[model samples]
Target chain A: MLEFLERIGWFVGLVLVQVLVLSHVHIYGYATPFLYIFFVLSLNSGIDRNILLIWAFAIGLTVDIFCNTPGMHTAAITLVAFLRQPILKGVVIKEVEEEFEPCISTMGFFPYLKYTLLCTLIFCSVVEMIDTFSFFDLKELGLKIITDTLITLVCIFCVEAVFRRDKSEERF
Target chain B: MRNLLDFLIKYKHWLLFIFLEVISFVLLFRFNGYQGSVFFTSANVVTGKVYQMTNNLTGYFHLKTINSDLVQHNAELSIQLEHLKEAYKKLTADTTVIEQMKQEALMDCRLIKANVINNSTIHANNFITIDKGEADGVQKEMGVVSGSGIVGIVYQTSAHYAVIIPVLNSKSSISCKIRRSDYFGFLKWEGGSPEFAYIKDMPRHSIFEVGDTIVTSGHSAIFPSGVLVGTVDDVGDSNDGLSYSIRVKLFTDFARLNEVRVIERSNIEEQLELEESVVNKER
Candidate 1:
């Protein structure tokens, strides 16, 4: 359970990196790269679900605080966390039923990549939708999600290629 | 009941997640009620200090430019002084008349030097940041001006920095009047262009032409009379020979804005006293 707290530490560190470092990097115009979701997706397999939802809100609130968009991050991260059960069901093929976090350990390389990609996409899309639906123009709304999700996908690919290689080899 | 309680405990994080998300969403869609909830504005103390550090690091490279700006300002002052001297030489013959005119026309004011650090010209409600802040005696609602013309009014002040809503922002308007004809109107930025703005509320009877000099009407406490604003460019608020909107070419090139002088009105209290008396008598 203390390891659950440790996972949160990783999330905070990644969010700091997102706000401090990646927030400055603009591929063209869009800045936010959706790096914090790595925390939610990479929780321990034995992690509790209710706590996961709270974690989702914390991550989103943290982002909204830094970005000045109050409710957008909270809504998006919560939506992703709420849908994790079904999303995990769709991705995980193993028959094992022990409650665990959806991570690269239980779900293999291809399956994990697909899962992260879907979660990142859905989270980014949900956030962008909530963010721009108020006053942001349609063009801005569309571009925001597309670029954010694209950047997130690229970051997830890089993170996995670098971090999950040993685990994948051990599984194979 | 015991089994239901255990099941509810198992799903607590999910409920918490929904609760937190709802809280965040409520804040996101809310705009009107939340006026001071700007925790992310660069004007925040920690973030402002960070930017100040960055500005200090970058400020070293621009010393030469700042110095030249000071020198140019001095040169203009010297030229105006010479003009005043010449006018004095001619008017000394009628010293009594000139003295009376000067007493009625001249107002005492001082200028505080400041440098621009941040500016947002693209937003409809544009804002500019100045290096001078509350620590340097800058208070809210002080009039800001450039060498060329009136810039805007001070909106917010931090310890070491102040933010101004310039004439180019839709959220602000400056009272201006025609110099030759004494027609008064409110000048405003329409949220489209920086170099241009419109003067509203002028009656159709007001005669205006291109190249007419515009100045502050001195009707508002923020700006004193005779400060340059801009020149009349075009009239557009034509409805049915009732009212005409006049377009003004702003004197300050907001895009090229760098140095500014914050006008510190010394007699503000006394002026406010006189104004309040008038209002009290009226009431």
Candidate 2:
């Protein structure tokens, strides 16, 4: 119950930050980091797949409501949620615990980095594709997808590092 | 029946995923047709309230720049007032005619002041949410303009908030003409930059220079004639090779937009009615 409440808190916090603060940051006129995806990225691996999809749909729809782009985020984030389990299985080593959440400390830095990079790339590409809905400006679309992925990846890593420090301190 | 039930349970997650994706796409495609729903948009009560609170905090940071802009505008207005006074004295011979024209212009429309609560330019179909809506006389298709120049037309409105489809959106097409030559075209944003838009369908024989000013042609009822749009930045041939596509540098800095006024055209319904009557007569 307490874990559920904490998850809910993180959901609200991330959505607010994404909508109010990060959404306004258009770095170099191309990159707008979508850090809200970090919530789904940090969920426990053992969680039910159906529940995970529902959570992703909720988050994406919330963002869509705020940003006035209905279903654009919904479709992208839903696909990410559906693919998360397979991607995690492929990336992580075999010895990890079933209920363990994927983070830098648990999955090791390189594997975690690879996992995040792949997920962010997929999320950004889907989002940019839906936004433009056409390959007419392939150069611009490619630039946006790359920049958004890099910026969002950097943000996710920074957030993970902060939480990782907190968990490590609790161990001491 | 047993086998069917077992299969359904076996791949329930996959089925759920596909179902959700199909629903999402439905919402995506249907959104353009029914964009006025308040629940799915930022103009809804919850989103509007949150944005209003944030704007209050962020509004302070822009005060310095807004003040300077206001001061410059005030100075320019004072100069114009002085020139108008001189012109009024010289035109006293035709004073009745000038007064009649002034009254007619004033009677055509009124301005309703509002603040932009939320705005975005990064998306291909950018939208702006304002603090005023139906309660404040704002309605769909009304022209929205900032102090500097044209902002956009109102797309939707709720009880106390409204959404504007700014010039940055691909769906937005405003009628504009070159100020010097009066040759007109449909201004469109092909996505990528907020600062520039392309004016399509200008006649091939139209003569316009790079620095020529563009303004609303007033061919439509939304904006009155001669509202400042932008200045011509470049000229190129349209894809069909029959007309010119001129690039315009927009005057309103949408990135810094704060306050705006919704033009309430008093005669809009009457004019629309008259036009419809003419069409019906022809039919």
Candidate 3:
């Protein structure tokens, strides 16, 4: 019960930060890093795919409401959520087929970084592409995608470090 | 039937994904406008409250600059007031001229002050949210201007908050012209620096130079005539090479936008009705 509540709190916290704070930070006038994908990344692997999709939709809608982008965030984040399982399967090793969260502690450092980077790339590309909704300027879109993905990856790396539990600090 | 049920169960997640994406696409294409349903937009109550809270937290940092700006504007207003008083006294001596001026004053508008609660300048289609809303007489199509220059048009308004599609958005286009020669162009932002926007479709023969001033042409009912927009920084040929596409340095620093005045034209409805009648007659 406590774990469930903690997870819910973390989700809300991320959405709040993304909407109220990070959305306002447009680094160098183009790269607005969206770090809320960390919520989708940190969810337990055992959770149902259907449930995951709903959660993704909910977070995306929350962000879209604040940013006034209508359905763009929803479409992009839902794509990330939908692609999460397949991407995870492709990245993870066969031996560690357990139902742990995709944090640095659960997945080894290299595998976790790879997983986060791939997901961030997919999510950022979807978002930037849908934002234009047309082939207006491919170069600008490419710049936005690459820069935003890199920024989001840096944020996710910071989050991974912050959330990593020390052995002495672990309750178990 | 059993096989169908089994298939349905197997593909439920995929179905859900498709369902959500469909809803998103519908919202994207259908309700993307500022006048679209404001229920899901930032102008809505819950989101508005969140943005307002964040604004309150960050607003304190901008107090020094905002105060100085207010003082400067106050001084300018006092000077204008003195000039207007002298003009009024002179005009009153000529009753016929005073009557004509009064008749023109009937078309005068009012300004409602609002603070910028949230703004984004980096997106291709950026939006700005202000603290004023429908209750504050802020309606869609109303012009928003800072003390410096025109800010944007009020796109959506809720009971207590409103969102503006500023000059920074790629989707934004405001009708403006050269102040010296009345050669008009449509001002558009092509997404680089927020400080500059491009004016398209200026006549190739029109003579212009850098530092030339551009102001609203009043062709659109949204903004008044001769309102300052920007100054020409660079002039170049349009993509088709037929017309001039001039770059303008906007006066409103959208990043430092703290307050704005929403302009409400008193006879807008009547003017729109008249225009509509003309179109109807032509059709």
Best model per DockQ:
2
Label model 1 with its docking quality class.
Answer: acceptable
**lDDT digits (tens) for residues B7-60 of candidate 3:** 999999999999999999888887655447888788999888887888888999
Taking the tens digit of each residue's C-alpha lDDT, what string does model 2 give over A86-165?
89988986766658888887788988998999889999999999998732588888999999999999999899988777
How much does each candidate deviate at the interface, measured as C-alpha RMSD after superposition? Answer: 4.8, 1.3, 1.6
Report how far off residue B246 is in candidate 3 (Å): 1.5
Clashes of each: 7, 0, 0
Pairs with backbone N, CA or C atoms under 3 Å apart (clashes), candidate 3 = none
Off by over 4 Å in 2: B34-36, B93-98, B277-283
Task: Name the better of 1 and 2 by TM-score.
Answer: 2
After superposition, candidate 3 runs with Cα above 4 Å error: A166-168, B33-35, B71-107
Q: Better model by lDDT, 1 or 2?
A: 2
Instruction: Give one digit per residue, the lDDT tens place, for model 3 in A1-172.
Output: 9987987898889999898778777777567779999999889888899999999999998889888888999999999999999888888877665688788767788889899999899999999998866436888889989989988888888877777665225946
**DockQ per candidate, 2 decimals:** 0.31, 0.76, 0.73
Provide TM-scores for the models. Answer: 0.63, 0.97, 0.92
lDDT measured at residue B195 in model 1 versus the true structure, 0 to 100: 84
Residue-wise C-alpha lDDT for candidate 1, range A1-172, written one tens digit per residue: 8875777678768866765556546554463677878778776555567777878778777765544455667788888887776777788887767775455655666887778878988987787666444345677667777888888878867876687677767779
Worst 10 residues of 2 chain B by lDDT: B30-39
Query: Cα miss at B184, model 1 (Å)?
Result: 2.6
lDDT of 1 at B160: 79
Highest lDDT among the candidates is held by which one? 2
